[model samples]
Each structure stands twice: as structure tokens, then as C-alpha cells.
Target chain A: MAQVLSLHAAERRQLAAWACDAYPHEACGLMLGVSEADGVRVLEVRRARNLNVERARDRYDIDPADYLAAEREATARGCELVGVWHTHPDHPARPSPTDLALAWPGWSYVIAAVTAAGMTELRAWRLNGGHQFDEESIEEADPS
Target chain B: MSHIVIRIPTPLRGHTAGADEVPVEARSVGEALARLGELHPGILERVLDGDGQPRQFVNIFLGSGNVRALDGMNTPVRDGDVLAIIPAVAGGGHESGGCKTESPSGTDYRA
Candidate 1:
């Protein structure tokens, strides 16, 4: 069965906000959550500084130190660092070949597309049995 | 040999049988990684390449500091110290601005 990405509506707004705030440049972040039986349930979304200044418009390099800090934060919350996310300024929210080449098999990869009008779409992907990305379903978390 | 704590990143956790932290005994980072590979079948190659160097995408950290800034994999480990594996998160579009980026080989989503 395909894996799903479960996220809260408010968190989805946070993704949009980050993407829009970054505007012309790419915005990057990490998602922390528990790996559920069917998919991932993201509990937090933390900003990751994009260290690629030369090609800020289309490129993103998440700060490794930020990842370490986020991992420790996730651990403290009994969650794990489950995924990496970034914005595609005006590009489509799909995994580019470079994205696929760097991606690992189990973690979710979320891509949000932001334009002058703001975030237009958000998508999730995961490596499949073929070692290639197959779009994963996004399940809106139930408000409790 | 030092008894140390090695924190597994989310992506590599599968190779560690879902164990977030593995207790390993070794005197140096290299030995600790070797022990990890022995206990977890697929992790060594994923973390390190044929040159015995960390794969381009993987980073090994001692506490909050990156090992690359330390002594590479030869960095010595002390008992009760902590290590972490963090894969680089990097990807960009065509530097050409007019063309999609060329990887060694893969579909150019922009095309």
C-alpha cells in the first residue's frame, strides 16, 4: 500500500506562510512526526535556513546544524524527524531529478509551489519499490 | 574501546531496524561505524562509500559539531559521547536559468 502524509490544517498554513515569505527564493524546512502504520503524522514543521545563496531562486540546501537541532527537538517531543520540505518558487511541486537522486527510500518529501499569489499547491512524495518517487497521499489530520 | 551513543537519522533508521540510537563500543569514529555496519547490514554503504569516506550526502556529527570540521572519520570517540548521522538536504534548479540542471543522469523535471 502507498504511504500517506497526515498533517494538520494549521500546519499546512504554516507551510504556505513560509513559502510565501521566502517569495522568489526557495524556502526549506523539516517535518517532525511519528511514523504511523499507514504513513507519517507530522506534528511540527520547523524552518531550515537555505544555505544556497548563489542560486537562491531555484536551489536550496538545508543547514545541517539546523537538522541536528530539529532532530533533538523531535526526540524531546517523542517524535522523529520524518521528512524534508521545501518550496518551488514558481516551479511545480514535483520531485526534480536532483531531488530524487538525493532522497532516501523511507522519508516523506514535501514540495510546495509558491507564486506571487502565494502557495498554489503542496504535494508529498516517497521513494517506491523502484527506488523512484511516487506521489503519496496527504490526509488532513482530524481536529481533536 | 569507548562505549558511545550513535544517533541514527530518520532515513537510515530502517537500516538500523528502527532503532534511533545504537550503543557501540569503539575507539574511533571509523570503528564505531564499522561496528554499526556489522550489526545493521545495509547501513555502512549508505553512510560511507568505497573510499572509506562518508558518502557525499551523509554527514557524521559529534555532538553539535560536524565531523568534517573535526577529523573526518578518524575522529576519536570517548565513552558516553554522542554521534549523529545527518544526510545533506540539497537540490536546486538549472544554474543555466534557461536549462534544467543536469545530474549524472536522471529525468529533468523541468524538461
Candidate 2:
């Protein structure tokens, strides 16, 4: 069985909020920091434009310059580009087949689902070496 | 007429008024989209190119595989077939920021 990495509650809530803001178009962003025995911690959240020319599709492209800058920033912070987060405006908060095919093995994929009432739900998954998905849970983090 | 299922994502739901999915029928993917445009005007421009091909950033998946690897917009769908429109993923840092951060375990590292 593959062990899915967990995320902090605050991090999940923040992501959900952002996803809602970018509703309709798939929201794109980066997850910062490393996963520890405790859970996945986020340092910051940055929003990027959905460069997919197909307005209603799942395909997205971050500007090359923006992509490079993000990579540099992540390295400087001593964190790996842990995962990519996006939203499924009116769909369930689950990874679609296209998502599975494009996902790189051994990385986390976060998805946020928004309902008509503007409610948000978030979930995380890990794509294993064999291209299988395992769901991870998000728990609230205690304020220190 | 052959019935085809077109899956709509949230961003484009405005064209379909928040409906998660719509059904249309045509001989080819392009034709199906044309029918969709008739039913929901202005949607074709968002999903197709001037020459009528799928926009570069848009990916049309037939079943579980991408149509680009198959036949582009010429990919045909049978009755009840589901076509998923997906956009390419964008935005991420390449170098400099490593996946290591301060944690209780001294330093957690990821890459």
C-alpha cells in the first residue's frame, strides 16, 4: 500500500479559498515546502493565470518565465515544488482520467471543488510509481 | 442522430449555465462541437482554433486517452461516449527553491 502525504488544515483551507476565487477556469498554483512525519506544511500560495487557450478545458500553461521564477523561488526556500493544485469548478473534487495521465509519479496532486453555492472542498492525492492514486487526508493544525 | 456526451468544466459552465455535462451528436469531434455551438453559441470559439482544430492548450480525451495522440479533432465518438476537455498544467518553479524546510525533524527535504 502506498502512503499518501497529509496536509495541514490551514493549508487546505487556504487552497480552497483560492480555488473558489478562480472558479469556472481551473485555478493553477504551486505548493511549497516539504512533507514531514507530522504532515505537509505550506509556506506560501501564489496564483497564476490559466494559459489554456481552450477556455473550458483542463489543459493549462503557466508562462515560461513565471514557471522558471517559481522554480527558483522554491529552490531558494529549500523546498521542493511539492505539488500542483487546481480546481474543478462544478465537478467533484476528484482526479479525472486526463489528470491521471499527465501526473508525474511520486508527486502530490491537489484538487479543489466548488459548488454552485460557492462552497469549497479540497482533497489531495499521491501518484505512485505504478501510476496509481492514493488519497491523503487533511487535518487542522494547532496554532503554535 | 448519434448522441455524444460532452463534459464541461467549471470555467466554461457559463456557456452552458453551470451544467456539468451536455449531450450533442455529430459525425466527428468538430461536427459535434458545431452542434454544440448551435445549441450554445460562442462556445466553439473558446475550444477551437481558426482552422477548427482544438486550441493548443486544450486537450480532448476520448475515454482515457488524449485525442491528440490519436487523431486530433478528427477523433470520432460513438453514442454515449464521453469526451473530456482538459487544459494543460502551468506554473511551477524550476530551480533555486529546493523542497527542504524547517520542521521538527530538523529539516524535511523534498524534490
Candidate 3:
């Protein structure tokens, strides 16, 4: 039900670090948080292993095992897996066709456009019916 | 009949009335899912293809065992079993580390 993505400052910083640390390879992760009436509040950003070794530079596949662990962690902390975040090494902070193909409804997606110059942009999105993405606004919020 | 719990992922929670976990009674994975479809209308279409097979982008797990690695839809279920449906989270750029694309693109709206 969340149409927007709100990130705690620390989580945002962590995502940024993940983007840069992965460098030329695409970085993938899970966002754990609570869903609010207006937006999804991201309390934590967990970097998951990208299993797409063959396409490491241009693609990412979050390991299912990591996803299982993330879901358990979220449950233990009384939160939900509200979103997924990834970096497009040198690409724009936008959803690709493959992104749409693998996306699920009711989850926010955050993309960071990273380059040798560092992260240039961070954008949020949600997939709706008809296999399309609707951009969502990102906000910096205080932790609960 | 076994009383099973299906762990609904966030993406499917909308169709599940926002309930993360739902209980059902069934004897096999297929029956459990069929009951879930009846309990949550819009979910089945997303999880299954027209041919009734699991969607390529969706993964179903009976506890820690992936159904695909087991008996799939025919996998037996026991009381207190947990079935989890997780969407495959994936995406990528071009091989050059830049997301070069030539296909007709989907609309990209800015908020």
C-alpha cells in the first residue's frame, strides 16, 4: 500500500556505500521495514549476494538463500521485506526490462546510479499492473 | 487434512489483505495453493502461469526445500508446514557495465 519510500539516513548512507563498494559490478540487496499508509519506511538495507556472476557488470540476482535469511531477519525484528535496492554501476537510476520482468507488486524498488564519480542519483519505484513502474518519491526520515 | 501456513511475501500481501501469513488446510502443495487462491483471489494469477506451472519469476518453498527441487505441485504437506512464495529479485545493465538498451522501452515517469 506504500506509494513512496522513506529511508532512515543511516540506511541511505549504507546503501550508498554498498553501491560504491561494489564498483563496476551491480550490487543487490533487500530493504526491511514497515509499510505505512503513504510510504514504506526503510529501517534497514541488507546487502545480499548477487549470484549472477556471469553478468556481474550489468546484472544482479539476489541469492534466494539470502532472501530467505532476510525475510527471517525482518520477521525477527518485527518488520517486513518492503523493498529491494540495487545499483546500476554506470547506468541511470531507472528500472530495466529485466527489472520489470522479475518485479513483484506491493514492493518498492530503489536504484542508485553509480559511477567512478560516486553515486549520482538515488531513485525509488513501484511496479503496478501491466508490467510498468511508477516512480515514487524518496524521503529521509527519523528512525522509529 | 494438514493445517498448513503459507508465508506470503510482501508483494503478494496486497492480495492477502496484508496478512503476512495465512493458514489453510490441505494434503499437498498444489492443494494448499489452490485453497490460497480461493482465499486470496488475485494471488494465483501472479504465482502461476496459464498452464498452472509456477511462474519463472516466482519461487515456492516448502519450508527450506524449494518445491522445484522436490515434487513441485505434488509435494506432500504436513501439519504446521510453511510454504513461502518469494519473487525473484533480479535486474541488470548492459555487458559494458552501462545499461545500454535497444528494445522499445517502457514508460519511465518521474515523481
Best by lDDT: 1
- As for lDDT, the candidate ahead, 1 or 3, is 1
RMSD to native, candidate 2: 18.9
lDDT at position A38, candidate 1: 92
Off by over 4 Å in 3: A1-3, A128-131, B95-111
User: Which pairs, if any, clash in model 3?
Assistant: A58-B93
TM-score of each: 0.91, 0.52, 0.87
Error of 3 at A38 (Å): 2.0
Arranged by TM-score, best first? 1, 3, 2
Query: Which whole-number lDDT from 0 to 100 does residue A7 have in model 3?
Result: 86
Each candidate's interface RMSD (Å, one decimal) is 4.0, 15.4, 6.3
lDDT of 3 by residue, B4-83 (tens): 99998887787888899999999999999999999989789878876777876778899888899999999999999999
Q: Write down the lDDT that model 3 would get.
A: 0.84
lDDT of 2 by residue, A1-144 (tens): 434445566666677777667666667776766656544655655666666666533445554334334545675786655567777777777876556544544346777777556636777777654656678765555555
Q: For candidate 1, what is the total of clashing residue pairs?
A: 0
Q: Write the per-residue lDDT of candidate 2 for residues B3-77, one digit (tens) a residue.
A: 888865433556887564688877777777788888888767667777887765556666666777888778787
For candidate 1, give the DockQ.
0.45
Better of 1 and 2 by lDDT: 1
